[model samples]
Target chain A: MSKAVIPGMIARKTGHIINIGSTAGKEVYPKGNVYCASKYAVDALTKGMRIDLLPHGIKVTQIAPGMAETEFRSVRFGGDGPVRHRFTKVWTRCGRRTSPNWCTM
Target chain B: MRGRRAQAVEVRGLIDGLMVVRLAERGRQVKPEDQQQQRKGTHDPQMCWLACELTASGEQEVAWSTGPHAKVAFLCPMPKLILITGATSGFGEATARRFAAEGHRVIITGRRKERLEALRSELEGMHGKVEARRSFILFTSTCATMPLCKRSFPPTGMERDRCAGEQCGPRRRAGPDPGRPSRGLGAHAGHQLKACCT
Candidate 1:
């Protein structure tokens, strides 16, 4: 992605690359090996891109969001609708909407 | 439910945070002292506060979560061309919508062609032009199919080379991978294995 658009950004001498990361990238959990690894790679790549593109005046920022109501939980649960529903129910019941629900799981 | 409302607020807060990052440098004059401070590895306090507010404080969420129709007073003077991946759903979709609502040109890529088209139409309806494509440029394991990126725009050679790093990891993704993975193991892996075996 950066490889494709970066040349044009360099030519123009300005660009902003905002990577949507996850809280999984910041902390590893018991069963989040693969997902966390991928996000960690994203976090690392964001920093790496920031450094490399510093000379080119391209800004690379990564926003690591905690869990929210999205298809992300469904995808993470392998499309198991019932499990995700029950999880979300339990999650909301506990009243931690702003806090990351990864630890409880 | 309160949870649902909270989720909506959280998502909107995220969109607001992204806007903050987008507008952080907007309409601000660069002073000699600021440049010297930047050179000295110090950042402006306001920028630091904005950055910290994103990750630390709930004040940002409260500030932007006034209502669904809330709009930032200051808009970007020039609409930026933004490329967002995984825009079929989740945060990506929200971000795309936020930016498109602000009248920025966007290029959104994802695996689901139907969803991508739907979003493209919805965003185009909201603002102006939007480019949608089915490109998986993130995972290098899927890079073998880089040349097959025949969309509205041509794939660059550097992009092809970046995807050419297919030999970096063991190939395991078989089922349910959103975008198509190239058939057969990457050819580069074959050469490397052959050399080591010989």
Candidate 2:
């Protein structure tokens, strides 16, 4: 998507690009290998964008959020009852303890 | 619920983060001595928080989101045309609201047409009429490749006419009008907001 609007930003010489990342990008979990890899890619991409867009006066920011109670959990679990319940308990405790710096609804 | 409170906190943080960036930008533009002098007695957390609150309340007349009013007023800036992808829910939705509340122009994109329209309506209702030409609801999926991204980037002919104006003609070249307060799409409208891969 950055590809689409970059030309115009180049012309104007100013813009801001904010990418939403995840804590999974910073650490790997037992069953979340693929998800971690994807988020790690986001981490790398944000850095690259900042470097490339710097001379153009465009600011790039990455907001890396940890697990929050959102549709993401349901989608990731695929609505499996027992497993969903188990993970929810684990996540809820972790969430309360640390209170993620960034969160999804 | 705890989840909802977390969302609210995170959303407030996101807006405050942006406000800090704007403050940093202002800092960079001014001389170091002036900034240092201006920083005297500015450590009052209560005053800073109050300034942010005033900004959140739509008091654009306050001049800036933070800092001393007299000095910051000169740096009071124009609203940016912000483009947010996956804006139907979650962080994107919250971020959209935070920025829209501050009177910035927001162009939201998502695959869910109904949800996108709903968000657009909700924001408009809160912020007053944001000219349709300046705000767009682009229905784009997460494209994986550069070629697919380039292809998906163009607005449909109907949207193009509504936004870019006739064959992507006259308006595209007109640039921004300095005299006016940016009523139409302006230079940024037609080719704005393409900052996501997913």
Candidate 3:
């Protein structure tokens, strides 16, 4: 993706790049060692890209979404039941403890 | 009986855009117009759209599925040009395949040039009706770790940086001698991701 944009960047001398990140990048999850590390790398890349490309009038942004209903969890856990239960229990417990009102369940 | 009752209430909410007033019991002096005004002040149009969809679908029973605003907006009139990395397998490959099937001009990239070539041939053969000019697959050695590789492309007329860094993953510290190009494990992974996006 970046390679495709390079030619344009050289031509216009400016550009912007947006990368999708996840909360997993900001905080580590159990058994998510490599994936977490990868997301962290994305965060670092966003910062670096911003600095390196800023002079050329390029902007870099990173969006780290939390608990989005994407295919991520199903794929990560290899199925829906076990991993979903575990994650829901953990997040629900955390939500209840942190903000009971917000934790409707 | 309990589930049936809940379903009836949910159906009512759907017909009324999930208004809190509609959920209130009979003769409950709830002013729905006021509540609607208050919600409109805080919620955006996309949120309103999502709320309507979820309530209509009866998924509102799930606590996590409370507001329509939680949904991601689907891009209409799909983009003509799309670039995907990690196109050799998994989500990237699936997405590239889907978009190409939808008749969009798609460019898929991956470090495994052979895999990309195979996919390209397969998609082209399958999508004979769609012009070959609309789809392409490119192979690149660099992965997600190296952004500089893509920085080399000539800028087309499109906005150069409208959504930069939004979809890119995190970065790691450059290994010693940044100038020296080394294909380590990290670089390989980086290349894989970059390949999909290209």
Q: B-chain TM-score, every candidate?
A: 0.34, 0.38, 0.35
| Candidate 3 lDDT by residue in tens digits, B1-198 | 333221122121111122221222322222323234434224455444443344334322111113433322211233345566767764556656555544456667777788889888776654443443354646565555245334222232223222222222121223233454433223443444355345
TM-scores for all predictions? 0.50, 0.54, 0.41
Which 10-residue span in candidate 3 chain B carries the lowest summed lDDT? Answer: B7-16
For DockQ, the strongest prediction is 2
List candidate 1 stretches off by more than 4 Å: A77-105, B1-69, B73-75, B128-198
Provide the TM-score of chain A alone for each candidate, in the order shown: 0.74, 0.73, 0.70
**What is candidate 2's CA lDDT for residue A34?**
91
Off by over 4 Å in 2: A77-105, B1-77, B129-136, B142-198
- DockQ of the two-chain complex in candidate 1: 0.08
Model 3 misplaced regions, further than 4 Å: A1-4, A13-16, A31-34, A54-59, A63-75, A78-81, A84-105, B1-81, B88-91, B94-104, B111-127, B138-152, B155-198
By DockQ, the candidates rank as 2, 3, 1
lDDT of 2 by residue, B28-65 (tens): 12223322333333434444444444434443222223
Ranking by lDDT: 2, 3, 1
Q: What are the iRMS values of all candidates? A: 11.4, 9.6, 13.1
Candidate 3, A77: how far from true, in Å? 2.2
